[model samples]
Target: MASSFSASWLRGDPRALEFLSDRFRHRAARAEAVAAAASRPLAPALHEVLVARNARLAPSPARERNLELLARPGTTAVVTGQQVGLFLGPLFTVYKAASAIAAARALAEETGRPCVPVFWLQTEDHDLPEIDHCFVPRNAGGPLRVALELPDAATSRAPVAHRHLGPSITGALAALRAELSGNPHADEHLALLERAYRPEATLVEAFADVLSSLFADEGLVFLDPRDPRLAPLAAPIHRRAIEEAAAICSKLAERGQALAQAGFSEQVHIRPGAPLNFFSPGGPEGARYRLDPTSTPGTWSLVGHPEGASVTTAELLSWLEREPLRFTTSALLRPILQDTWLPTAAYVGGPGEIAYFAQLAPLYAHAGLPMPLVVPRARFRVIDDRARRLLDKLGLSPDDANAPRDELLARLAARDAGEAFETPEAVEARLVSAFASELARLGERMAAIDPTFAQAISRTDKTVRRGVSRLAARYGRSITQRDQTTLERVERLRAYLAPDGAPQERIHALPYYASRLGSHAFLRLVREACEPFSGNLKDLKP
Candidate 1:
């Protein structure tokens, strides 16, 4: 799960760590101190929106108490969120929430002040393809992609809140039923999904329902940014963003450059003449539109239209008053908006998110918001018992399983019963070396007779090397194909631990494990596995 940027920051590349507020600490004492001093009044509208949402869900005394604390004065939040993915998208989604909950608990204990966990629902995101699928593990030991296929769903630009799960969900469920046919927990979990993801429920609603069910006892508040009531609370920030739009864009570009100089790459692209926000027309079908500055003073052009309409700044500000939810922050601006309005002690993020924060690090000061501690979420390289046994039988490490399917199988097959699987590689190396030496001697002799003949010698040498490599690869594959036992073990090992060369936590869904462990046990394991403030990924049973 580590990107070059994330590995730099998380593994303590000192230059990379400089972008953060604090580092090298296993406790939230310093962050708690900052949050204690950074007291701000709650966004008046959010309390009602959050409390109402929580009331509609299953009863959890712990969650109920967290909700109460969130409404009280001087309560700080430890927030993390994801796009409303089907069945909670990837496993990291759960890891993110667990990290936030862990950070919140540490903060409350450290400061003796109220702190609560909040999961912001990114319902405004319009990329349907990103959230339409969930990977279920098969009985034979591999991933099964259970996706809802709606032709319109793929082509539409509408936000997830508008994507009603209609009849297409039945197809996805049927596919899931087939995958989980022999699973014992299938009846209970599928029934839970059927109830949550009904024909009438929007994608966001179903995601919230399932996620809330899992974390019912954990008290993670789900906040919808599109809630009409909260628009007024966000108005001042929106206005300031519009008025100082160019300046903010300039600051972001400069920060992106600074990140590059520090040996890191920018995660969010900063465009010239574009501000840190998007404009939606405020309807179920309206797509999120990008706004660009016009040459005329205080006028702007909406980028989505083929023929852009020039609207004055006054007109844009009016939308904030009448339909303020029309305006939402960009990837970089969202942290500012969240931290400014909510008393955030820390923000739990994965590698990519943390890398983005580095690009927008200085923007907090530009927006006049108190920067929250950006904590790297605890990571796991999940492996089941079956995968463990295969790895041992093949004498391969967990890291070795991350290679591509054919290459990894080739490696394991080479170590199988006979030298047949490895003979081609030895033959290839010897042939290439001998051919290169002969080619060099031939080239020298030809150069003495005619300088042009040296080029032919070089070309022949290159062709010979390429042909041998392909033959060796094909030979190894053929050998592996003949050994059905090795093939099966390699498939089982790679499929469970590193599907498509990514960790299981990233490729598989919560139910992939929960179906095996049961909800209560899975949740308990997640809570216990959360190594808050410890910037490291470790092996765990759950």
Candidate 2:
């Protein structure tokens, strides 16, 4: 097996993530400018929840302790996500939350702004299957795979499944603590985490409960949109969002038709006319949907019915007009809210999150929101002692990590030996030529010994070729080892970008987030490539 991979392996996709990372490295100044004006109340409701949750099991309660120090007026809210696990994925799931908290603290120190980071638990996300897995470092002794422990009579309806949250999470955390031998207070940490995520709470609230431990001492307020008081502030946004979503849905129908005509089996849906997301009144009871009847099938609700009463486009628009504030908070209202929140100085996001944010810029402007400045989350490329030692042994540079492993190995080997061997193809060709020459010489000698000499010579030639083939393969494998080491490292890093795998690499995932970091990154290098395309917003065809 080959060892190394290069940025080239991502093909010529300008939107490839690897390329975007390279480009974004130069845009640090722009990001700083955007982070300048953002502000929030120090002791936001969200931060308090985080502290309380963390305090439950924590021996010292650092998260809660930190919240007490910084809980005050004039703080900036830092937000991020976690996949219901401690192990962050290739996309830096844990780091996203950590960075937000860290950056908030750092920013608070610098700007004199009390910064508190909030971890938004995506409980409404229906991809139950995706959140079930967690990665453990090799030294941690392999990855842990866990599944939801749904009850026998558990219906898709809220109450049955709602009860599953606390146990499943507690059980999973316990299992993880048990697996890690000799880790100090593993049980305590897990217990503290359990206090953070409560079954009766909203996904956002549950998220606050667990993540609060990380920043509770900062006096962070854990605001749950599920909180009835906050509901009023967000409700208008929610209702309008749903109404706006109806229009977006109409646009999507037209776009889908065009995609179908273009011979696409699966459409790249942007919800062009639809809003990005909406807040619901209660968990499951106030469920939000992208469209009443999704173009894609199998969209039955928990009770086996469509989400809302099917209404004509005109009727939906009228409903939005009647309760503009309420519908504004629906998926229909997303584009408008984004527009309302516009001139957004900076939006902290992971690479994929950035890409989806980019997609909304045009829609935001169309909906009258200012185009916000985009910033990648604090990034990390982990290099442990083993990784460092391996790099040193190979005498490879950080830049070399971006090169094709096989090529880098060949180069390294040639440098070490002061000479290089022929390519595998060339070596194979030489072997074939040598076998032919030997067979010719043997054929004449064989004819002198017997009449069946030609057959004998043919057999001899086959034997010689087989021997060369075997020898060549053995040599190839040995050479591949050098490249394999590098390849493994690159793949490991790639894993963080997408734990499940890259969006395009997957069967049905969206390139929305991946494209955000990658495409935006590549834009710097290949601005000229796309400059020919006008700024005109081309209407998606019906």
Candidate 3:
């Protein structure tokens, strides 16, 4: 049996719940608007670009078929994407892809339209540290965060797509293998990871290769925006962003403010006068920089690089026309660009993505593009036999695993103590009540004797309460010490349920589960467990 819970969003954001519930009255209007916007026929050149990119990737038969489907005249896609992370990042990456695949299938069935699932690889992001590490459970005990350190050449402000795993990746792989050796499928799991994270492979290629291997049979098409072939297709969107730099900034700022006013903080901060495009000039020495509106009316200045230069709108437009691959969309504008290039029917996203879309709605409206239906991806926490047995032994649910460590430990210790130990709360409450009654009587007697005696009584009352609190603390310590086995059990459970005090899916990488439960079994569990747009955290018993 499996247990589940609703996803807890940042600052208790209700937008995801509302979106999932169809509570927003304007949802129909938004859908209609998106439908109209997507009704335009896709360009022939765009199809050629996708075909060319697909050919370069050497996609699986299923993926190649899906790419072919995407080239059809009226075909729209269901899209979801994430930054390329180590070993495919956390489990949510797989969940996100699964959700997109399921959503695409469902949408095609309902609309009688060709819809393909596309996982856009966000390889243009330059934050290397964010994707450098992944957590895996140590064979000894607890979880270990393993990272492949980058050399100076690969550590520049260049996008991750251009970065390669150097010699150091072998050590990272060795460490990962050591951790997984306890599992029966360790050899197979390590082989897959090694094949993907080869020393000579770039991060983007590695991510695409591993993801392609995992979801190839499911026909999930992987798109790398940095592909030179798609540069011309994305040029128009980049041109619009550069030309209307000020207007786009203004619209984004206005929308961000609206989102904040609606009690949701903006996910992507819109800096005043900042263009929603990252510019990377051609050449090996070129570094990525953010574009900002210049003092001149229609010019934009490159910021974040010491040698950054200003470009007139005409110059920027010319550069985009010539080399669109040099420009990348910012987080806020990526969705709009995606919709502009691909006929996106729906976008499957996580909680944060869903909240951020609220801010992008205005951007979509401003761009004359329809905001696709933002569907929250299904979230899952895999529980193997070990975790399940521990949970059952503790007689706890998955939600109980989220309790604070100390609180959970105390609860378990108390239960193990049976009727022998009284909880600190009960003891403190009883003591306070008894002390209150006695203090009241003492206060009456002291007042009768003399006013000074009242002060003494108050001091004595404070002393007694402090003594009681100290005693309670001592008792709790004693109980905790006496039940060492219970404490250990709690610790073990914590590691399994909330390692590093976070959900397993957020902390452990996919290889951890794939090793414990064979890769095929793990993938099958995820596919069977995931319920697209279900809007609930799935508890999977594998």
The digit string of per-residue lDDT tens for model 1 on 397-435 reads 888888877777776666665565565667689878888
- Ranking according to TM-score, highest score first: 1, 3, 2
TM-score of each: 0.92, 0.54, 0.85
> Which residue pairs of candidate 1 clash?
none
Model 3's alpha-carbon lDDT is: 0.76
Candidate 1, residue 133: Cα displacement in angstroms equals 1.5
**Candidate lDDT values, in order:** 0.77, 0.41, 0.76
Q: Runs in model 2 with CA error above 4 Å?
A: 1-78, 82-91, 102-118, 140-142, 150-163, 166-171, 184-191, 194-207, 217-221, 245-268, 272-288, 292-345, 366-368, 386-542
Worst 10 residues of 2 by lDDT: 533-542
* 122-177: candidate 2 lDDT, tens digit per residue: 34333344543344433322234533454432233222113235456566555555
Q: CA lDDT of 77 in candidate 3?
A: 83
Question: Which residue pairs show collisions in model 3?
Answer: none
Looking at model 2, residue 529 earns an lDDT score of 22
Better of 1 and 2 by TM-score: 1
